[model samples]
Target: MTDFSVLAQTAKAWPFELARALEKRVAEQVKAGERTAEAPVIFETGYGPSGLPHIGTFGEVVRTTMVRHAFEVLTAGKYATRLICVSDDMDGMRKVPDTVPNPKSLEQYLQMPLTVVPDPFGTHTSYGAHMNSRLCAFLDQFGFKYEFLSATDCYKSGRFDAMLRRAAEKYQAIMDVMLPTLGEERRATYSPFLPISPSTGRVLYVPMKHVDAAKGEVTFTDEDGRDVTLPVTGGAVKMQWKPDFGMRWAALGVDFEMFGKDHQANAPVYSKIARILGHRPPEQYVYELFLDEKGEKISKTKGNGISVEQWLAYAPDESLALYQFQKPRVAKKLHFDVIPKAVDEYLTFLEKFPKEEPAAQIENPVWHIHSGAPPAADVPVSFALLMNLVAVANPTDTSQLWGFIQRYAPGTTPATHPLLDELAGYAMRYYRDFVLPAKTYRAPTEHERGAMAELSARLKTFDDAPTSDNLQTLTFSVGTDHGFENLRDWFKALYEVLLGQSQGPRFGSFAALYGQSETAALIDEALARG
Candidate 1:
């Protein structure tokens, strides 16, 4: 294995940091003799098909791969492990997907296990397999060693049978952890890989008790203790969630698994299940969810998401990597508007941290990007701020916007920021192609107009040297004059008056940070527009 324990990343992400922690813990396990030297370090990920994989989805795997690479360097071949990707395609259809045509007919069978759904693509052996295989393809491109296990595969291999028996054997303990997490009404079973897919109009489940995929049937005692064979495609994996974590550990020997914060009970529940299974639980890293531009959780299952595929169309894969590199541990909404600024922030960071490993350098210096010492690790620029700056710069005409772009983002000249060239491309594309054109918010109400007139009168009185506090006061006062809510509201009005658009970026900070003259001129333009 490489020297994973102490590997250095100039721009460290959560996974890199987590990798270090995981190594120390594994060493502790080995020293305590709890794990043999030869035991594999299993990195696992579970997937459900609500829609196309998003950047967050790839973030999990890429980060894990980084950790796995480090672990390999450390073990030097003494330890072997693989990232096991469990596609819970057999899970029930939670919602009708936009990607699929007319899933309404599939709705009646919505709660059925995934095994029953006919492959919409009609290519893979089953619908579940088809959904999972897409992910497998993406991972394959990344060249990570992964085992794509469907629920069907696990049951067919009798892997789940052992877990089911254990769940029955450890029934009380399962509920002890389960009830507290899922609530008193929910059932506690021990399967994580179960899924529900749709087939025909009827719902089918892969019975939780005993599923046999080989014969396409499940064995269960029909309450009367009579052994019955149910169609495998109808029912789905029956285990409750908490016990499923334990089953994963006991059956798969999983070493580490990360999840999003939505699964709040996962940690405690997994712990309880671990005790019941007589196996150590996997290391856990819980992450926050990604939101859309409006701050709603990005979900393709609900026909909402700025998907990874969509993101790739605009952002370079590595830029996307850099986006996830900062694990803020809080929910963030991402959208196309983010790109125009993200490009500059990333370029600035790379400029600041120019020293990086050979792997990071391009064959050509002109095109090369190296890590900033801290890689500007955080290029703290806000979209609102940049947009405001742009507003001040003369974007009224295409030529003026280009001129303004040249001044601040000099790379547009090719002599300065070659990266800016790309940013300009993306920015121009976004404005021209993506941003929906609409009328500005209704003309400021009379009270708002009066407040703006007041602010104009006040500012009209002084030509004082600008300061931060003064600028702050100006933004707020201007809003008051306009009868607007606050400085932000004033700025919005200013944008309409200048560019004939709603919502101009930050004005006061831009004026303070850059200068008063540029901001003043921008304001003049806005007053003209209104």
Candidate 2:
């Protein structure tokens, strides 16, 4: 038998928000005093399959999986853990996503369950299946461990039939939980189960004419005035969003789930519905939504934000994971501009993690991002600095970049420093895409030229392999003597003249990474202003 007492204490000291939630959930389960210790803990994440999965989908699953891993550690083999990625594929198609083709044709399928609509891309059996495949591909890209569940399959297979009957048996109770959330007009006629039109094959939201819960059936008149009745068990009807949420909890026995902050209003209704069905609601955590550069919530339908494919083009998956590992509740802007900084920050965390104490290690972001064993901290240079070097050096290949890296960090190779090598490529791509096109180099002033000359002369005093500390001291002295108010302006001027960029990585580190002799020549090149 595993004793989680010590693990529980350790979890309390952990600083991550997700970890803290896991600790609380675990402690609650232990306190419940009725459940068996060996029962599997169900951790779930939800996806709306109305459109292609975006980067936000990636963030949700990855974050939840991180918490699942932490829970496993806390339990220490006392309980099994299962992560299920549930897709709301049974939801009606509200709008055609810009990413999909044939918009005009898809308009006819509006209000139909995505599971019954044809795949516009001709990829899979149904639109929902196509989107589910895309989500699986995206998850597989990151090697995520999860079991995929389709709402359509769950409803059709009788797995959720019992819950559906329960929802109908307590239809009035379910409506009570949702009516308070709706406007006056919508409250006049609302049913928890939306029956599918047998003739038109579309989701019909009309008021249920009669619900025979004992027979597990719902009858409704279609818009065409045709009487339709079907058993609620076999995909003939699907529960509405609020009640469906709780039904899913009771059916799957989900221990934990997370959602966006926008859903905070509907959470209580879901909890109430779960209780009406005689099951406790799953533990829930709300994370802030990702906003576009304009500070509006990113929309999957409008394609207003960057896609997962777009992010992977210019940054590593680990960098994206690092971004998700930050405080989950704080809203952050997501755009191409954030990639370089995130990549550099990831490297910094990797470099610092090995030196931290054992207790401090658990709190480090890299520890959670890597899920315990972080990669070796072999990167001696930052991604920002590498981008700067890529811009100035204009290397035709990675060897030139590796040449500079090998000089200061000797004997490191691509195999030894995979992340650094991969980041070098991303840095170059980012420089070409975002940095190089907009850069305009301003000629240094006469005084600045004199400072550069003095800086070049001082660098000649040190041999080819000067220490970074010595290089920093000399660089600072040049800034002080040049009458610059702050050292930041000094570095900006140097970057403007040398790299044609207004800002760059730490000047001392850059100077030492490039040999002392090469650095002096670069200053001379900047001073010549040719």
All candidates: TM-score = 0.63, 0.94
Q: After TM-score superposition, what is the CA distance of residue 457 in candidate 2 from its true location, in Å?
A: 2.5
List the global CA lDDT of all models: 0.57, 0.83
Per-residue lDDT of candidate 1, residues 149-200 (tens digit): 7755675567766666565566556545555544433434433323322223
Deviation from native of the Cα of residue 264 in model 2, angstroms: 0.8
Give per-residue lDDT, candidate 2, residue 299: 80
Instruction: Give lDDT tens digits, candidate 2, residues 306-360.
Output: 8888889898888898888787889998888888888888888888888987566
User: Which whole-number lDDT from 0 to 100 does residue 314 have in model 1?
Assistant: 61
Q: After superposition, how far is residue 390 of candidate 1 from its true place, in Å?
A: 12
Lowest summed lDDT across 10 adjacent residues in model 2 is found at 7-16
> How well does model 1 score by local distance difference test?
0.57
Which is the leading candidate under TM-score? 2
Which residues of candidate 1, in runs, are more than 4 Å off? 1-13, 69-79, 94-98, 102-109, 140-145, 180-238, 293-296, 301-305, 356-424, 434-530
